[model samples]
Target: MDLTYSAQDDAFRGEVRDWLEDSLSGDFAGLRGRGGPGREHEAYEERLAWDRHLAASGWTCLGWPPEHGGRGLGLLQQVIFHEEYAKADAPARVNHLGEELLGPTLIAFGTQEQRDRFLPRIVAVEELWCQGYSEPGAGSDLASVSTRARLEDDTWVIDGQKVWTSLAHLSDWCFVLARTEPGSTRHAGLSYLLVPMDQDGVEVRPIEQLTGTSEFNEVFFDGARTEASLVVGEPGDGWKVAMATLGFERGVSTIGQQIGFARELDAVVELARRNGAIEDPAIQDRVTRAHMGLEVMRLNALRTLAGSGTGSQGPEASIAKLLWGSWHRGLGELAMEVAGGPSLTAQGPPYDLDPFQRLFLFSRADTLYGGSNEIQRTIISERVLGLPREQKA
Candidate 1:
């Protein structure tokens, strides 16, 4: 398999690198490292403004077809853009759910009207989005989604709870997975509906994390309503559409995430040097392993993207999830180790965690969110290895 970038691709990479360098240098320099994974609350409005600046510059949604308000960039160029953005330490994006997840899903499965209604807003960052997938008992077991919606004339009324919904409190829209056909069970009778978040019946309560931050929330949709036409695909087709959205989640954007991961690793390594933790053989060994593992992850993700293109990743996406999740959690622990005794104490009595401390705490969920490692393993085993499905009790 070819891993080399074409000369044209390399030139595109240079263009991306130059653009990011120019974009993040002056007025946006303060946002260089803010509003990332665990710190979405940092300078949030500023980040929102920065995201609009990106939209204005036409830097968003590079992989979508040009007819859909995108640049229609190829796979390698998209990868290059993400890589350069991370290298430039660009501000954390404020619209990943809308841009990365939903936009591509619509391009593939959504009706023309759905595209016309949503794609431009998503491209322009006019509406922020959150995934309404995980529920109280159905975090990774999507077929167990208990949220229910029923059509009422021109609207669909929804009622249910969604837990661990990222950015639900801040989102202007939610794409919900609900049971539309009453008695059907296990992946049937479900629908993917796009619901607005500002109505009177919707409630979002922030879920505080171990890092003392709340990037996700518990949302209660009590008699919430949306137009009946908002369902992404036909009824009973949520499983297919939702799976595709999740597949899109594992796309080239992760290269930017890995670049951030590399920065964290570098910090840990520098601490090891200054604090003399590098002298410890075990610490040295773990550090080496972490660096090597990240390289492996980069290569594997490139291979997966090359074959799958944009929105249609297969079982290999599960492998990508499992690899990065475990590796990140391990890096968090290693950060604490390298920080030595100082990692335990916060800056204030109430608590102000240093970056490493926050990383250690926040990365704890790396294996849990966006499909748990256990779920990824199950997908790989059942779909790739020809294994039988595990029976439910």
Candidate 2:
């Protein structure tokens, strides 16, 4: 991967930086550094407005094709935009589920009508979306999903439950995977359906987390209905389309996530110094290792991006997931350790968790969610390394 930027890329970076500084100053100033992981409950309405503001300025979907209402920027320019946005500590994007995951899926797999109907709304920040792949039984084993959907006269009827759905309560739609063929097992006979969330057949209940937040939720679809044409790919081809979405999930946005991770590590280091934990050899060694790991992680991500196509990522994306999931979880542990005894206690009566405390608690799930560490390793071994597949009893 080229480490040097051309003059045009540098100019583009300046444009992004200037826009962020100018726009985030007055009315949106309070949104800076708000509504991230563990803090998703903060500034709900305000952040949604900030998202719309981003859309209006044409900064929302920088990488999408111009035909789809995006700027259609090159890969390096998109990278610069994400880095500059994170550097400004701008409000966490509220529409990432739509922009990053579902938008690309539609462009790559959706029919022309699907793209015409969904892409513009996604770019405009008018319709937010959530993923409905995980269930109580199929958290990491997506092929084991039990959600079933069948086509009636004009609509597809859905019935199943999805857990760990982030921002379901605020979303306007859900892209779901369901069994459309009876007696089909594993990944076969599945269809990817885009179901609306406001109908009477759908119910959403928040799941409180260790951080005392309910950003994640449980969605039950009794007889939820969507247009039969809402399916992304042909019936029984959901596995291919869903896997492509997963590839997009781990795409260029991760570079921005690593930038955020670096900021978190910087905070941890500052805490260690203030508490004199930096003087301890053990603490110092761990901090050095964390810093080095961040560098390695960034390099690997860039390399992966270089090899990946514009719309889909390769199996090497699993390596990125494994790296960051483990690194962020370790950073959380380091934060608590540097804080020492004070980290053990809540500062207030309501059991409030400070930023570091929340980091420690929320990062515990990093290696578990998205795809578990075991699942990532399996993908790396079987798909990337061409190892023999694990024997299924």
Per-residue C-alpha lDDT of model 1 across residues 32-67, encoded as one tens digit per residue: 989886788899998898899999999998888899
Top candidate when judged by TM-score against the true structure = 2
How does each model score on TM-score? 0.98, 0.99
The CA-based lDDT of model 2 is what? Answer: 0.92
lDDT of each: 0.91, 0.92
Write down the worst ten-residue block by lDDT for model 2: 306-315
TM-score of 1: 0.98
- In candidate 2, which residue ranges exceed 4 Å CA deviation? none
N/CA/C clash count, model 2: 0
Residues 182-294 of candidate 2 have per-residue lDDT tens digits of: 99999899999999999999999999999989889999999999998999999999998999999999888888998999999999999888889999999999999999999
